[model samples]
Target: MMNACPEKVIRMMDDYLDGEISPSEEKELKDYLQSCSDCRKIYQELTKTIAFVQSVSHVQAPPDFVQKTMAGLPKESQRVGVKRFMRHHPLMIAAALFVLLMSAAMMSSFSDDQQFSFTKQENLVVEGQTVVVPEGQTVIGDLTIRNGDLRVDGELEGDVTIVNGQYMASSGVINGEIEEIDQVFEWLWYTIKGTFQDAMSFFGGDDQSIEE
Candidate 1:
């Protein structure tokens, strides 16, 4: 039998076998192992056991495993149904919420005594708080104004549409038809349809004119 080593040397030997010791600690453990036959034997047994465990634990997945497992599952149509349901549920809820909020806002505005005024200043078309047309004494394109009253004191070469508000033309020349939309629902529908048309025109490379 080999001579017994100290408990401290055995602990250091275990640390060295596990590669958990610093270089200096490893050197100390190596020196001790060379002098202590019992510790060296323990280290040799630990190393062999670890090597055997690693060799047996290395595993590779079979090539046909995924294919075979998927073959037993349900069709993609069933999964797509669930996915579409999940996707559209949120969109439907969001759409409903948006409609509700818009309705509330429109109702509140309708009840209020708020009045909007539009004016032509130099080359700028001032509508309420926003300035839309800049420095064009004469508008050459179709002018569509929504959610406010419109007053034109200049010349327009194209059609004019006023939604959810009144239209007043004073000394202004309109070369095309003037449309007035006062119903809230009609205005909302027209706005939404116009937006969709604009998006389609942008993506489809079409030169369709949409109401602004």
Candidate 2:
């Protein structure tokens, strides 16, 4: 908002939302909001957010909620036990996590075996790191090329998935999705997300929007 609402008007808007603004102040705020789209947008957003919260029925915790929670928690003397344990034995925890991460990464890398790994060799030509679908050749079934790039100068009847690689789509007819995935880190991230989402779906939870 290059030209912002006056500070007094902003305070008036807040007061108006809270039902504490004087009649004159409320009029001033409305007049300013009508003229300034920037302030009006902000005010509209504030109204939506506030209205959502305000419109909800007042909910009270169960009678035993506080008691149950307090009973489950440790006594004050030992409340900081976990923190103290972590502080004193950081090395052990760190070592275990480091080993686990390394083992998982190693297993993933070994399983990948990206040395010219692919699915379906028919109708495709491999030239070093470049996989090519020559002109006039039509390949059937999905083609997954790992640790390599693909040049599609011909027709592909199914999906073309490139792992840790790139592709050049020229004058070719691709009948399905052409997916390009980068190396280990990205693959690992997607694997974890997929697993988590699967678990959530299984439990009837909505898919979470988790981003890199």
Candidate 3:
């Protein structure tokens, strides 16, 4: 019967078969293998297994495999269209945003520069220039002015609405609120609302006058 070999000799059997061990270690393992039948059997099994794996046929994929796989995907034009759309979508959105911003800025600038004035009178004077409420003057009812500076030196019994102009009030009395419309959007909204109200008032006043 063959004697049991050391664990180190069994571990070195594969390394020795592969010529991976140092010369001294290979010599030691070879000497032990010659004396140990069990270790020799293990080494023969590992050597046979490695030879079998190396001798096996290596199968390759078909030459058209890659072409067939790619053919199953989207066509070049379809992919190009998608990529082109994706590339230009941001530019289109940016251009639209730029146009909107420019439009808003233009409207704001136009509104700021646009000129308007109220009817002139002794108590309420309006000119192409600044509107000045002379000192000690008293004006009744709501006052609306546009596109001109307002210098209030007297007393007003109603609200003051100024558009696209500065309101300078020093030692003046306003019995109602002071509203300034400086932006295009704000001025547009106020003008539309005031026009509607005036139309409604005119119709209502006509009905009242007819009834009277």
> Of the candidates shown, which would achieve the greatest TM-score relative to the real structure?
2
* C-alpha lDDT of residue 137 in model 2: 96
What C-alpha lDDT do the candidate models reach, one value each? Answer: 0.64, 0.75, 0.72
Instruction: Give me the candidate number with maximum lDDT.
Output: 2
* TM-score of each candidate structure, all chains considered together: 0.35, 0.40, 0.37
| Per-residue alpha-carbon lDDT of candidate 1 for residues 98-196, written as tens digits (9 for 90 to 100) | 566556655655654245433333354675644344333676777665567656566667776776666664666668888887876776666566555
User: Using lDDT as the measure, what is the rank order of every candidate, best first?
Assistant: 2, 3, 1
Report how far residue 34 has shifted in candidate 3, in Å: 99
Deviation in angstroms for 56 in model 1? 34
Compute the lDDT for candidate 1. 0.64
Q: State how far residue 194 of model 3 sits from its true place (Å).
A: 3.6
lDDT of 3 by residue, 1-212 (tens): 23376778866875776678999998888888788888888788888999999999999999999999998996677766655664557456445545565566556646655657753545975545677777799888777777877777887788778877878857878899988988878966665565555555655565453333
lDDT of 3 at 129: 69
100-127: candidate 2 lDDT, tens digit per residue = 6556755776577557677766788878
Query: Which ranges in model 1 have alpha carbons more than 4 Å from their true place?
Result: 1-68, 71-122, 127-136, 195-212
